[model samples]
Target: MRNTAKITTAVLAAGALTLGLTACGSDNDNAGADAPLTVAATPTPQGEILTYVKDNLATKAGLELEVREFTDYVTPDTAVQQGEVDANYFQHQPYLDDFNKENGTDIVAVPDATVHLEPLGVYSHGVKKLTDLKKGATIALPNDTTNEARALKLLETNGVIKLKSGVGYEATPKDIASNPKNLQFKELEAAQLPRSLGDVDAAVINGNYALEADLSPAEDALVAESPKDNPYGNFLAVKKGDEDDPRVRKLAELLTSPEVKKFIQDKYDGAVVAAF
Candidate 1:
């Protein structure tokens, strides 16, 4: 689940300072090959899944895993790019691409044996279904590039709104081609959408945030992204040159193990789907 923590100027300054020190030889690349691989993850499925591997699977596979939980999106990638952590496991490819383009960071995904798709779900306390949404209903949406577009697509898929043809992941509220219900849009930070439910008619929430809020998408989402052919599955990621590190390979293997697939299926009960 995402937290509403302010990414303050001080935090950014501290991150820059850490980047400088990391370059002078304190990074994981210089550590012993068997050193614990620290992974930064969002708290819900990513952290919980890593913790499972750490407690029950890492030792037999000859891996030392340390899971560091982050409540916001920026820090995890920032921490990994700066070598403050060995890798991170919380973002989809689209978001990662956007981040790299915007921040001038060179993070890349570690190919997993399988991918896990966290479907963006539309949730509401006021309505039981999308049809129940009234005209002029206020809906909360993610303000970020990838997710806001993804959220809008979900609505379009459910016929809540229609988007311009060929406008897919790049679609924004401005791309909406039709809104028969005349719904109102309230765009907020992705991390803040879950909490905005009480203030709006409904909210389009990221799957991880929905889980952190204890909302089961399978049961509660008015609608969610379909796993079939979905390109947004989240994967373990690392700084460009670190992809081949032994520790990183171990964690990636564990993440795709049979036990992990079963854990996800049983725990999330379809809220989270394994890509392999």
Candidate 2:
């Protein structure tokens, strides 16, 4: 299961930092018979999936695949846009779309693999359950366009609020038609939502940042985005014309391999489902 959304974005400053392979050297070309093709990936599932390839698949493919690790969401897209990397295995289509729209660049998905589906979960601090909320409890949500709508939709589905008669993917918190609990919506930066958890009654958080804060989606989240009901499935991002790149195809193949699938099953348990 997956959850995704399209969001319009505001511009953020990014320095064009070139990430070279510390061990593999500058061999991005298809020039040498044994030269490596470099790909950039985010820390957890994407980079973890690439580690499997680095350890197992690259040798058999007659290629040495180098992966650069990234933490900030902005840098990978910026790196990809500058042609500093051949592929990136971090964002979903929505984030990619926003990054392109904001930056006026054309990074595309080379291989469409929803390798990991991290949900938006609402967890409480003082209250053990949602039923414990007072009439005017405050619940924080991500302020960004895509995630804010997602948080509201989740709240609506859980009977926490009521939205207008008919609204689609682009709906925002302003679309909420009812709020019986008088739940104050505290909108914060997605990256900061988890840190604010201790102060609020409950907070809706993205899974990556949750995990970064040492909260596992399978464990600490009170209620989360179930693949059974979400759209933002993460993917492999690449430059627009390079979808057919051989290394991209192979990397996607290896990621979806049974070994990787079982690894996800064993590691993340139910938190990060492998939608490969």
Candidate 3:
């Protein structure tokens, strides 16, 4: 009886070890080179661009690509940090820095993977030009930290408003040094800025949201940020240790390839500019 009990215990222990090994093997398989690289992106240019690569470039490059689209800014980074997705391609460095700092996530950009720049633009339904806006006019701005500062800077550049001296990407309404037009500011989510145009005199919209609403940054904007010397070029990002994944490297290469650059110019017609 004693010998039988000891044998039973040993068998059970060995079986458990085998199951644990199998589980580890399964995890390794999922992280293997051939596994699909799932990416999260906003729908407009980022999703469209990734879809293009998946359909046209990925197979030829020996990569399996999957793109998931999210409308809001917060989900993609969270997804990447939680390992829900392999990577994301919807944000610039400043915004990623701020997100990581605030959320305690360790997301990092792939080196040299800056794909494109979507110039932030001010759009208005009733106003024909930035200077034409009436006094006490209410203008909508994105409520996010980095983008709000970018919007304020654009407004300053167009002589619509003024920011405090030496205020950089962290600037806010509180940082305004001058208000020549006495503009009333309305802060809303970036995704909601397009719909706010009718409610406000003008709106500073991120380029992706503007494109989703069929508004062209080049043609429709009262004032658009200049691409030259702009620091807000969106890039591919991954969790802290996944930068060396071969699939990520392949996608990064494909994103910066000449084909993508041509595609951006032709498809967007100057609305989206390739940074690579």
Question: What TM-score against the true fold does each predicted structure earn?
Answer: 0.90, 0.81, 0.89
Alpha carbon deviation, residue 126, candidate 2 (Å): 1.6
Model 1 Cα lDDT, one tens digit per residue, 132-241: 99999999999888889999988888889999989966678899989999999999987788899999999999999999898888989989889999989889998888
What stretches of model 3 exceed 4 Å from their correct place? 1-30
> 271 in model 1: Cα distance from truth in Å?
1.1
Q: Output the TM-score of candidate 2.
A: 0.81
Compute the lDDT of residue 147 as modeled in candidate 1.
Answer: 89
lDDT of 1 at 269: 95
Cα lDDT listed for each candidate: 0.83, 0.71, 0.86
Which candidate number would show the highest TM-score if scored against the true structure?
A: 1
Tally clashes: model 2.
Answer: 8
Clashing pairs in 2: 1-227, 2-230, 2-231, 3-230, 3-231, 3-232, 4-231, 4-232
Q: Point out the higher-scoring one by TM-score: 1 or 3.
A: 1
Candidate 2 overall lDDT versus native = 0.71
Q: Which clashing pairs does model 1 show?
A: none
1 or 2, which is superior by lDDT?
Answer: 1
Model 1: residues >4 Å from true position, as ranges? 1-26
Model 1 clash tally, residue pairs: 0
